[model samples]
Each structure stands twice: as C-alpha cells, then as structure tokens.
Target: MRANLCSLTFLLALTLQITYTTSKHLAERPSFLNPCDYNGANFDKCFADNFQLLFSHWHDGVPGLKSLGSLDPLSIKRIKIQQDSGATLNIVAELENMLAYNASKAIVKKATLDKSNFEVDATLELPALYAEGNYKVKGTVLGLNINGAGKCNLEAARIRLNFHLATKLRDEGDLTFSDIVSLKAKILEIGDFHIDVQNLFGGQRDLEATANDLFNQNWRELFGILSPTLEQTLELVLKDRFTKIYAYVPATYFISNMPRASEFYG
Candidate 1:
C-alpha cells in the first residue's frame, strides 16, 4: 500500500509539471494587439492605437522650428486621410527656415502668408508596404515654387520624407524607395534674386550638424508651396507579423491512460 501510494503521487506531480510548462509557453508567445482570429472586427481599433503609439515617437523627435518666434509647433492647419485597400494621409503645416548666427538679423525668417503653402497631392502605393505589425509613412514635397516679396523665385526646390515603425522584435520588410525623383518650378518676379550656392550647402550642413539646436537663431519662414496628391498601397500578413499564431495552432496529439491492477497484502 505504501509503494502504491508513492507511485500515484509521482504521476500526479508529473502531470502538474507538464501543464505548467505548456501554459507558460503560451503566455510568452507574441500576440497581436487585436488578433484577426475573429475576422477584422477589431482591426480599426488596433490600427489606430498602434499608429498613435508609433507616430507619437516621430512627432516628439522632430524639434520645433524656432524661426517663428513663440509659435506652436503642433498647430496643423489641415489634415486629410483616406484608406482604401491601403491608407493615405495628407497634412498641411507651417514650417520655419532658420539662418546662421553670422547672417543678417534684419532678415529674420518671419512667418508669412506667402510662406505658408500646402502639401501637394501625391499617390503612395500602399501594397508595397509589407511590414506586418509595423507602420510605414512616406511623403514628398513637389513643385516648391517660392513666390513672395523678398528674394522670390527661388525655383526648382524639392523635399522628401520617409517614416517606418515596427513592434516586432526584428525589423523585416522591403521599405526602400528609389533614390532619384523629379522637381519642377516656375520662377516668378519678386524681390532681389541672388543664388548663393555656398550658402545653400552651408545652411544644409549646419542644420544637419545642429539638428537639435533651436533656442536663439534667425531662419527664413517658407510656406509649403505644393504637395502631390497622396496615394498609398499597403500589404499586411497577420500571422507572420505576430508570432502568437504558432501557439494558437498547436500540433495535434492523442492522450491515453491504461488501467493498472495493484494489491495491498497483509
């Protein structure tokens, strides 16, 4: 009887151990914020929450342009978004351009109505975006024609923007764009027109070097002359993006228990 009791106790302990190990593994697996297990009912909510979390980081990273004194950086005038098979977002905001300290102070890059332009419409192929469990945003400024009072007709200017975010442990996706693109502009009549090739290169290098500098500086306020209409194409693979799919679809197995006869002798 003593031996039999001991054997039963050992079997019970083994069973408990197996259960604990399996449960722990399941818990550790990576899961989607809103799993697509139940159709796409929760897709929208999941997308919004994930996007905000991702964009917040980007918004915070970009230091406020101080060329416009005491102006709010987060004040975006117009925003438009459209999601078909993919998603497209268009945003319009005032941007300030700063000048070097040695430059003229009278030429403060003050904010002007002519300096405030809109992002031109552009189409982005969303399907090309394949970073599941990730968010990717790309933008480009085209046809930047500077037409205003002082130093107008700064023709043939261009700007480009690219953004990417991933929640997965590893960054896996094809998120690269072609190096070469085009820009076109028409020179308009305005203030003195002077082309300073050296100043242009110097200004760009300075901005890159002092990317975080913002306190006391004079900069030119340039409006977003135009932006291409936004077009986006995106592709998502839910299972591959989240590792939790492996746990939910575990391998099939059969469990069987055979009866054993035991006798207690006096």
Candidate 2:
C-alpha cells in the first residue's frame, strides 16, 4: 500500500491541480485520529479499519495528508532561465505552465490488509490536464531569442498501479511499516496534445515556424526522456512518507495475538 500511495503522490506531482475536497458519498467521521490500538479485542478488524480510513482520506484528499502542490499549474509562480550555449550549436529554452489533478477520479481496484502487511491497487483517468502559459527561447536557428505564449494539454486515458507494504512490530508495542515491498504501474495513452507558440524573433517568419514545427514533431521524445526520472523521484518521496506514518502505529494494533505470532502468515 505504501508503494501505491507513493505512486499516487508521484502522479500528483505531474498533475494534482486542486486541493482534495470531501465527497458526500465517502464522507464520514474519521474511524481513528491516529494509529489503531494494537491491543484492541479485534486487532485484525482495527487494523483493517484504520487502513480503509487512510485510503479514503488519501483518495479524497483530506486536510492532513501531505499535499505536494509544486507541480500544480496554479501554484507555479514562474520559470525563468538564462542559458549560454551547447555543443554542436548554442540553444536556449524557457517555459511555464499550471497543472492539476482530480482526486475524485482516482479509483481503487483493490485493498487488502493482513496482520502486518497491506496492499492496494488503483487507477485514474484524467480527462484533461493542461498548462496555459507562454515561453521564450533563443540561439541555434533564430540566433536570437524568440518570445511566445500558448497552452499545452495532456489527455491521459488510464493510469494503473499496484503496491505492497510490509510491517514489523517494535519492542515498544508499536508497528513500523517497512519500505515498499513492490511498486509497479502502467501509464497508458497520452493520446492528444496541442502546442501553438508565436514567433517573436523579428520578422523571420520562416525561422519561427521552423522552430515550432521541430518542437511539435519531437515532443514525444521529450516526454519519453523525462517520465522515468519523475517516476523514480516520486517513488522515493512516497517511501519516506509511508515509513513515517507507520512508525507511530502501536504494535498492538497489528499483533494483538502476540502469543500466536508464530501462526500469523503476514
């Protein structure tokens, strides 16, 4: 489950645009404000209940969840850069945009918890995630900076992921969630895109048109190069957060049957 949550966070970095709002259908009083009581008579039920509550809050984006808004289009203040040159030739590029994610659309396919292990699988289909902004660049072809502004939209058909988590009871009667046991995802279909940047590098219409044309032609390559790096970064961030949340969970909540620990499968 840690991997799953982290994957969602990573997706948010690429997309989350608005704060999560409570849903009438899923809304309810929180089952537990903190970790479950490991010593509760029904420790298994208590553990499952707590997991469900957290999952719902994450899916709906309640107040206390770690909200990473840096990549959100609205939160992006500005992106300014001054580059000198490059090999073969000199080039420059400056761009900006706003991004957002729809928590309401995040769908959980499966969630399972046993003893000290947890797992979750889910998918999300973003109708449209876009950035409405401008850009400026120079060097290489135009030999001079050209200024332009436009919009970029990404329509993702589906995003599917699976995550597994392991936990151990501590000497202090608390539980500690191990690092993600496994994290896997398949992001499919970014089928549509639009880019229109006007040429501002003097009256060289052909040069500007050429630059825009080249960019449009190779945007896919650019996305391909960047996606993997972003995914790894997100995985690390989620792992850290998961460990912290589980650190404070009382061990009793997971091992109420400590005497029979040898018989527990997870």
Candidate 3:
C-alpha cells in the first residue's frame, strides 16, 4: 500500500521526483503530515487518504524539498542474485534505463500509522505496472548457462503490495516526531511478471533460444526462487534514495503531534 505510494517521499524518495503545484506547500511546516497524528480518530484512514492525495499530485514536488526527480528509467548500477538450485543460479545485471510506469496511479487502499513509532502498514494496489529496461546481465539459472547482456521487458500487470515499513524517529516531544526515514519494506506480492530477456549466451543461437524458451516456460518457478533477492535488491535501492531525499529536509518537518500513551489510558 504505502509501497506503491512510496514513489514520492521514503514513499516520495522511492519515486523521487516532483514540483508541488498546489498553493499549500509541503514545506509549510506542519504541512499535510500533521493530521496523521496517532491519537486522532480514524487517523489510520487519514494517513492513507493523504498518501493517495499526494500520490495523485506527485508531479508537483513538495515545497522547500529538493527534487529527487522522476521515477521513470529508475537507474540500477547492478543487481547480483545467487540462488541455490540443483546448480547455483547466479545473475548479475546492470540497468541504466528501467521504466516503472503508472506509479502515480497507485492507490493506498488502507494505511495504519503509528506516528510516534514511525511505523506504517498499508495495502496498496496499482492497476497496471509495466516496465522495460536495457540491461547488461551475466548469470546462470536452472540447468542452463546464461552469460550475456541484452534488452529486458517486464509487464507486472497488476501489483498488490502490503507494506510494513518503519521510519527512524527523532522525538520533538509533545507527541511530535521527525520523519527521519530509514525504510525497510516487506512486499507481500508483486504480482505476475510477464517478461523477456534477450541476447543471452552471447548469441549462441541454440543456447539463446533454449534459455528464452525456459524463461517463458519456467518464469513462475524462477520468480519464486528469486523473489527474496529481488526484494532485498529493491530494499537497498529504496533505502539509499530515501536517505538522500530526506537529508535535505529538516527532521522536524515530518513531526506529527500525536497523543501520548497516557491519553488513551487516562
């Protein structure tokens, strides 16, 4: 949920690009983030709603925050994956242009926030998520030997992710806490990826054709075995970018005035 919305903030940092067109600037101290208070009635829904609103307006970068730029062609210096199968399957890929489409169309269906703890759990759905990238890859998977670089395209038709992510909070007291975002996301499902990777085996016509056939035929199993590596890879990407974006904003900016523990009991 939040993961889909994550494009614009840690959430944004993931997608990392913008300009806030609205007169209400995100830099307006207390911004839209304040109402996300923990003690506020229906605050969880409040947070979710706000996330969706902002996602819809993602093209407009937050005021007073440095633009992290667009999510399209998200760059990846490299991804190295090693899986234990009958024979080790290892893949190392470097992508300069990776397109993640329709990120702004993400819907945060539900969000539960613990502002004080800097935690959020949300369910996010995106109708269509399609990506294509130019890749240089070196890897071996299944019984096939794959070594080469080529073009890769992926169609993750519909994406549904349950995000359990936390921010490292710095307390400003009085229930206010700084965003201090350090993101670690747990993705429940990324949906099915209909994909194609070309030019493997250095164009060994026989092996290349066979590998392509195998990829199309055994994609499900491959993804199952590779999901962990994929998740870890995404986590690294998000964490690095999230930190870079948040670095410019003062920690206090994300502070939310939440009710103290005593309020609920007293």
TM-score of model number 2:
0.43
Tens digits of per-residue lDDT, candidate 3, 6-45, equal 1111111233445443332233453444445545676677
Q: Encode model 1's per-residue lDDT on 102-141: one tens digit a residue.
A: 1011111111111012111121111111101111212211
Ranking by TM-score: 3, 2, 1
The estimated TM-scores of all candidates read 0.17, 0.43, 0.70
Provide the overall lDDT of each model, using Cα atoms, as 2-decimal numbers. 0.19, 0.42, 0.56
What RMSD does each model have against the real structure? 28.2, 10.2, 7.8
Worst 10 residues of 2 by lDDT: 1-10
Flag the better candidate by TM-score, 1 or 2: 2
Error of 2 at 234 (Å): 4.2
Task: Sort the predicted structures by lDDT, highest score first.
Answer: 3, 2, 1
Candidate 1 local distance difference test against the native: 0.19
